[model samples]
Target chain A: MIPCAVTGIGQTRYAAKREDVSMPELVREAALRALDDAGLDFDGIDAVVMGKAPDMFEGVANPELFLAGALGAAGKPMFRVHTAGSVGGSTAIVAAHLVQSGVHKRVLTVAWEKQSESNAMWALSQKFPFQPPVAAGAGGYFAPIIRAYMRRSGAPEHIGWQVAVKDRRNALRNPLAHLHLPDIDLDMVKASPLLWDPIRYLETCPSSDGACAMVLSADVTGDRPPAWVHATAMRSEPMLFPGRDEVSPRAGAACAQELFEQAGKTPADVDCAEIYVPFSWYEPMWLENLGLAESGWRAVDAGRTALDGDLPINMSGGVLSSNPIGASGMIRFAEAARQVRGTADAHQVDRARLAMGHAYGGGSQFFATWLVGTEPPG
Target chain B: MRPVHIAGIGQIPNVRGDTDHDEVQLVQAVASAALAEAGLHKDDIGFFCSGSSDYVMGRPFSFTMAIDGVGLWPPKRESHVEMDGAWALYEAWVRLQHGDVDTALVYAYGKGHGAPVDGMLTAQLDPYYEAPLGPSPMALAALQARALIDAGRLTERDLAEVVAHARRLGATHPGVPAIDGPLDVDALLDAPYVATPLRAHDEAVRTDGATAIVLSVGGGGPRIGGIAHCIEPIELGLRDLTAATSVRRAAAWAGLEQAGSIDVAELHATYSPQAVLLRQVLGLADAVVDPSGGALVADTPFVTGLSRIAEAARAVQGGAVRALAHASGGPCLQHNLICLLEAR
Candidate 1:
């Protein structure tokens, strides 16, 4: 595929709650900010692509129809994608294809969630016939998987806590991060309420109401100092089967391998990463999946993946902070692009040239990833 | 831009209710037929996109269960849209434009038999303002039909002719339920008015069905030509529903006449008058239209529009015609899509 670029990025002030604004207002703040960041306007955008988790979460059958007016998608070619948790990344992939295909010059991509609007756990529980009724929240479904991960990798128990603490501490620097735990520490996360045995309430992502947007452009049409899209890829497998590995699915691994292969680089070339970490343990879990950790060894040892460490991960406080389910994935991609464009303020990795954005959803079976670089890739 | 094409097309016979077969079974039949037509295997495609609505399934993530049809054993890079299957084809086209994958599978299914089909369409209405009225799609379309009648572009006999030809043609076409021939226009206009002004014949025979199409970049599929899609706002009050916004929008985007010319045209017009409306809205000058009876005779929910694209592809692939195909969605033809195809 031809190289696409991310020129502008925008995000709302992540908070425990955003009450005064409607869902569209929350999304508009991010989109307009992205337009401003990209130095472009509505006229410059040729099309729009929007993504979110599921329509049921918002109580709106098709949230895209309602959001059409607010997202400035009145007449232009507009598309809405729902790919479970990976929708945010999928949304960006769809938008990037518009530019890469030369179908649209500049495309506006946005994903958002008003988790405060509805209970996701309840929404996901609306079951049908012939399906398992194990809808004990996403964490409950993954706790057993985490146990399997622990047995397979022989990693210690404290690694998950390390991830929660590092992400919370990093929140202090990102102005847009939702959960800014100034007093966060290892003991605090361990002491937090245990929602699911292995996943603590504090370690879990908050039901945030926020939005993220970005302006993706072709190389020739890029207006701002663009985060040249080095490579983008996505992969998915069935949600469950006899042989499917829930903890570390082949889909996520294949997605990562393809991401780097398309970029003509390796995981070591990545300077920072904004990975989907809805729960603390997924931090180290995805580390090995992304090929950062040694195979079968899934812990961020050697003080890596920290803000000051090599391959810093989730400097935006990640899903652990502001996890507006649908927007969570796009936020990761937007942050990576921001780093490549050298526009990341407090969370910026110093002299970072390459960054990665990653997301997985639906029983850890679906994955979307991209590698962005400061320089354009041939 | 790489020339995109339709490598394969498949469809299930649109039935009122396949009581013996479920949605998954229906999807499987269509997928197998399309792949067999193109001589392609499931693994040969890199991207898979499906279109269906949760409202129709009466459950969320409705498309998840339908994957059994594709035999997605190893799992594939797949996505879904809460819209018509025609839009799924559009999404596939956009992915190919990125110049990444060469081939894609686009499929859609509508379970009209799940409940009262007309009641299901009520979900498309505005929940706050209009849905409370419980205006069934037939009645709502009748409103627009009234406006067209008042304007004198059509008369009582014209409506009947559309239905007569549609059903008569349906009786001969395979997969179409045996509808009888040549009802009177006045009789149709007076068929107790299911809503008002618009009669039963004005609407297509509602049925449960599934359809699928295989698309390739650079016209690499069995058939070839131009493919384009453009969508309008969801609000009917926002635009003139009486006009064909989708057709005009799609025609302009596809550069309908700019490219080599169109020799044939097919559109998803569930309502009889819609065919006439699209012809004028798209300014399709004397194209060989709907030789297969089109949507008026038998409209198969979300798959109807994509069926039109497949119909166009089949014609070109069979050396029957060389031209463009159009599809539509939304209430009273709110959204429109146009694709051009040619022979090798």
Candidate 2:
């Protein structure tokens, strides 16, 4: 495969709502910052790949059609990608392929979601002519799965709180995180109202309005250290099937396994990880699903994934903090790259060598993963 | 990177509406036929990508149910685009370009019959300034058509002659829907105008259907002749309506100069005048043009551009054409895509 590198990254100050800027202005803010970080201009970008959640989230159909100009994709080959929630990660992967395939020297990847503009729950719960309605929306779809995990793994309810407190505390260090709860704790999280039975409001990701962009190049084109892309993979399964495991999704596991194998590393060797955790429980759940932890998710409760412990996960606060639906996965990817580039200030992992970034959507079936390293792998 | 080939193509006869089959079933039948034609199974596909619009389906994530048609058991790598099927094919082709997967499946489906096809199309226009005015997409196209007519670059007679050819060509085809015999240009012009200066034939019917194409990597599939696609500015004011600048851009990208002499060329002309403009734009006057009719007859929404590619591929595989096929989208051909196919 042709070599690729993450040369620049930019993200907006995520929040519950950003009425100050329209969709175009919001996306442009991130795009311009990314361009500035890359030390390049609009003419320098060879192509643009845009990503977002379902069109209903924005009340716009095929957003990129109208967004082409603001994204600096005018009169250029612009591509749009939608792979459910993992769209951001897939969007980045698509842009990377343009560079990796020698089709383009540089590609700008952008993903954003302004959920405040529209009700995502109602949007996602659109009643089709024949399809069954998802009563609880995303949380309802995932709550039962969370219960199944509790039953199968025999893990205590406190494990979810541990993850929530850890990520919320991590958000204290991230200036861009949406729900930065500097004073939150386990008891506080347990007290939050339950939206989807067993899944409290605090346990779920907050709806946020934000954008994220990254200018990826084919190898380090300048003196700046590049976050070399080692391997990238994506996988998807049926939304609902008889034997599907919703808690530790097979798609996620297979994606991470193949990605790790391609990058020639094991879960233990990963210095840091940036997994999608829109819900607090997903931290422990995906930990087992990603093979970073063994069969049951005991690793999370054992403190093996603590910041100062064996593996540092979501040092950039993760989706639990920001949760810009379309851009969350890519934020994970960008943050992972930043850590390896030694550009992450407050959330940097010490002496990070390799990192893994992940995102999933479509009832936890669609998955995208990428491995990046400070030193180029042989 | 591996050279990806178009192994098989499948599409139903494109009429304005196909009420006989549900959209999902329609998509599934075509996908099944295309796979079996290539001697492949649903299990063989390593990648899956589809294109369709939620608005067209009157719901969000319209293609979600269609994913079941693939029986995504092993959870293959997949993606979707709210674009024409041809563009979805482009995404699938990009995945194949990596040499990571050998096969990619791409499909698109949208039914414009139930939805406010006209008003819904306007949504694709500039939402902030253009859509608010409610300049019906056809009315906007007519404005550009009037400019082309006033420029003396095209005439009403030219438009009718193009439609006459489209009707005859469509009637003789094996699968094209038969249109009412030969229309009168003067009568058409004299006919009440829906948007002034343009006749009903000048407007495409509200079409709904699905199309699918199978792509194989490293020459493992059918030997595709050539593939070329291009885009025009989304705004009408960006270019001359009479001039097919986007078609020229696509032709150049397809290496029209190096493609040598051709046997047949299928052009997607939703409107007869577009046929005239496309001929001038793609310079296909010397080639065998749309023996299987054109968009004037069997115009499907979203999947129509893909239908063009499939029809041309069938012609080439049948030893009928050794040249190019064109497809397009957006109002006034605001967005254009061209594919050059050859039988080696």
- Candidate maximizing lDDT: 2
Clashing pairs in 1: A101-B97, B3-B218, B3-B219, B4-B218, B4-B219, B7-B221, B160-B185, B224-B342, B226-B340
**Can you tell me which runs of candidate 2 are displaced by over 4 Å?**
B15-17, B172-187, B218-222, B225-228, B238-244
**Candidate 2, position A250, lDDT:** 83
Tens-digit lDDT track of model 1 for B116-231:
55765665555556666877777767766776787776665666776776666567777576674445555555566666666767888777788899877654444545556655
RMSD of each: 2.7, 2.2
A52: Cα error in model 2, Å: 1.5
List model 2 lDDT by residue over A264-360, tens digit each: 8888888888999987778888888988878435777777666776888888888888888999989999999988998888988899989889998
iRMSD per model? 2.4, 1.8
**Residue A333 local lDDT, model 2:** 93
- Residue-wise C-alpha lDDT for candidate 1, range A1-378, written one tens digit per residue: 556889889999876568878777888999999988888877788887888877667666566665666777766777778777898998898888888877888889999888777787777777766677855766888888887888888887777888889898888888888888899998998898888787777878888888999999874433568899988888887765787777777778888988898889998899999999988888888888878777423336556888898779998788887888889999999999888888888888898899999988877867899989999987
